[model samples]
Target: MNLKDEKILSAWEEKQSITGVHKITGYNWQQIAKVLSTYGIVANDTHEIILNLYDRGKNAKEISKITGYAETTVHAYLPRVRPAYNENISENAKRIKKYRQNK
Candidate 1:
């Protein structure tokens, strides 16, 4: 259960969940949990993983696909996940347009 294992460390840095790391590395949950504990990397729960994925620029739909949550559920959690979440797609578009124009 060494954090020095490059494959595991890379997955952790990518914010992959324990299950994801397991899938990638063929490690069981216990081994992954041990590594997590040894390295003080708190295992991310579902809610936190969703937020982390969002923070990494995944949209609700994408998060839904990754997490097996419905799109509506992802949408429902998003605002609570981050304060000042702009649900207005058009507003974001306008801001992006303006920024690009200025640039």
Candidate 2:
């Protein structure tokens, strides 16, 4: 690969957002993504990357920063990838319902 392609690949491998890399390299995200795909580097969606990072113990705020998404958006996706989070919410709801019935 040429130096420009190499730089784009390096930035992508480093987990930098496409938009962020584009800002630094002056190439649009589509161009960068096309180069990555050409080299067999499958690009993942921002949500999927966020979920993986969350599984790795990164919080919503940190994931938001890395993925260039709002913290609220990251939090919204957490339940989809984190079964434990959904379970906890369900358990809390059950407990609240039981408490109200008992009272």
Candidate 3:
């Protein structure tokens, strides 16, 4: 790993009270969390706080504004609740495909 990633890993390993990697690297907090997740990091109180903030009416931008999270992090944690977000187009594949093929 590069020096930056090494530092990020150090921060996670230390489990410091708050995210310290963001201050010294291009990595954002969410990106750090994503890395932690990739390595099987368990959920913690901070994760719960993120979930709670996302569950409220606040949009990602609003969550970012209220919380200290980066804008990207707020967005990363706050999608997938809308009907459009959950929509699936693969459900009617057979009928749709037959009609299209006949045409």
TM-score of each: 0.37, 0.38, 0.36
Clashing residue pairs found in predicted model 2? none
Give the root-mean-square deviation of each candidate in angstroms.
Answer: 15.0, 15.3, 9.9
What TM-score should be assigned to candidate 3? 0.36
User: What overall lDDT, based on C-alpha atoms, would model 1 receive against the true structure?
Assistant: 0.65
Cα RMSD for predicted model 3: 9.9
Best by TM-score: 2
Worst ten in a row by lDDT for model 2? 79-88
lDDT of 1 at 64: 98
Worst 10 residues of 1 by lDDT: 79-88
Q: Find the 10 residues in a row with the least total lDDT in model 3.
A: 78-87
Task: Give the runs in model 1 whose Cα sits over 4 Å from its true position.
Answer: 1-4, 45-103
Query: How good is model 1 by TM-score?
Result: 0.37
Query: Model 2 over residues 24-65: C-alpha lDDT tens digits?
Result: 788876567556545655456754676689779999899988
lDDT to native, each model: 0.65, 0.67, 0.57
Give the per-residue lDDT of model 1 (tens digit) for 1-103.
2333467667777756877888788867655654554444656575567667877999989999999988865664453332223434577788897999999
